[model samples]
Target: MLFLPAFLTLLGSVSAVDIWLNFQTTNCRGSGSVLCPGLEPNTCCSVPGRTGNPYTSVTVMHIPSVWNLDCRGHAGNYCGPIRELQTSNGRNTVCLGRGPFGGGGYGFWNGRVAATAESAAEGNCTRPSIVSLGDGTQYDVADLNDDDFNEMILLLTSSFHSFDIVEADGISDDVPEKFNINKLDEASLLPRYY
Candidate 1:
């Protein structure tokens, strides 16, 4: 029985990464943020039910050399189709709400996300190739498995107006940064939906 405890401790020490999702852009400090600490490789790490999909930014830490991160914002309970945010190296404070599907236009994924870290050495996951349509749209195509058929396809629309990319280091949950006044002003100028 004692071996079980030791084994659990050993498993905990083998965790490959840590991920943070925030409701606000540019920072990882907010009431709607969540931290998925000590994530194991090759497994899906989802947002808790209470938090839902209010995430607009993300931060990843301690990425392993053999692992790749895949995060997506879904419009429903299932982790369905959407543009993915993949990174092999650790990232700090990447905004997710500045794109056409995010806050810039449709706001489809402003508050929805599901993430995972998979082992690249396992040969089960392959990065998708993004192709531009040259008509303000693009699509991602990938055959994740070794199968001949393409397994994933995501179409992305582009927005004419661009937003600044927000980056930060070492975010804390205790104190959140003040909301950007310029962004607020820009939001005020946008047409509101009924």
Candidate 2:
């Protein structure tokens, strides 16, 4: 009787192993074809071109936690390259330029690699242009709503403008939660966010 009681008590305490709920049919992906959180796929937003309307391309590289900071100060959390995008009509395709740094701010580029200038120029039609107006000095780009998307804020030597990058098919949804906009300063041999 004691053994039976002990066994019963042990069984009760252990409880029945919860049968793994087979949720294979639960459909984690909502109705949209996009990934979770309702973000469109590869939708890249870009700035207008000076002449023939340059485009943009984007790549995601998980930069090592270290080696993120170098000659360039901490412009963003993860400072890296923005690849230059090729023109749809097959025109001039410049590479993503680099400088002192400023995209969203310190810590914006954390863990992100330089997104190849080629990719940056390709631009996303889905995301809208985030630049508002500017004497074009410095600014911050980020997802104001913190939705893991991106927005641009222009901090020019003369004024400040904020705008959303236009979204494109397969390019719009790749932006980070926020970007440290460091391109508005010093006339250089690089392209401007016109």
Candidate 3:
């Protein structure tokens, strides 16, 4: 019927989630853990850190949809389009990847927070707080709904691509010392291809 068109449009608009956060994952992550497009096995063709280091060239983007601008601005040049991930039970999450480079991007970083100074000194952080990277920048250091104990939420201006609600954990340190990356994946949003 004619009404179907209008309804579909309405549904599409409502489902459009704006991603605005970036969580760097370990190497080979951007390619979904399989293989980068047109890339040779073990060869680094990414755009950040060390191209050869698979664990350092990928990012696990977080699209919370709470800010109404989760991931929207830059496209990271080589990153893939954000796509909806599959989830079961009652979990809800979304994600994407930024190929590499330009880690200290624009948007809220460390502007001013009590733990900003401490976070700078400690690097990986150890508490529930926000790090102020000065210059009006601020970053949210919280759980990010993932099981990772040290999740850092970078408020991006916009995300180039987007995915649906899923889970993403594992930064080689998202969990306790007893567990490994594989275990972490069980409790977080795994890279669809990674």
Q: Highest lDDT, which number?
A: 1
Q: Candidate 1, 185: how far from true, in Å?
A: 37
Worst 10 residues of 3 by lDDT: 34-43
Candidate 3 residue lDDT tens string, 1-194: 88854554454344422122233342323322211121111111222221121222332233223322222112222222212211211212233343332221111122332232222222221222222211222323332344332222211111213421112222232223432322321312323332
Better of 1 and 3 by lDDT: 1
> Cα miss at 120, model 3 (Å)?
37
Alpha-carbon TM-score of each model against the true structure: 0.34, 0.18, 0.22
Per-residue accuracy of model 2 over 1-194 as CA lDDT, tens digit each: 67854553354233311100000112211110110111122222322221211211121112123312111111221222322222212212112222222111111122332342223323422232222221222222323442322323111111212312221211223333344342234522112221
Query: In model 1, where do residues sit more than 4 Å from their true spots?
Result: 1-13, 26-32, 48-52, 65-68, 71-75, 89-194
User: lDDT of all predictions, in order shown?
Assistant: 0.29, 0.22, 0.25
Return the lDDT, model 3, position 142.
Answer: 37
lDDT at 102, model 1: 21
Error of 2 at 170 (Å): 30
Best by TM-score: 1
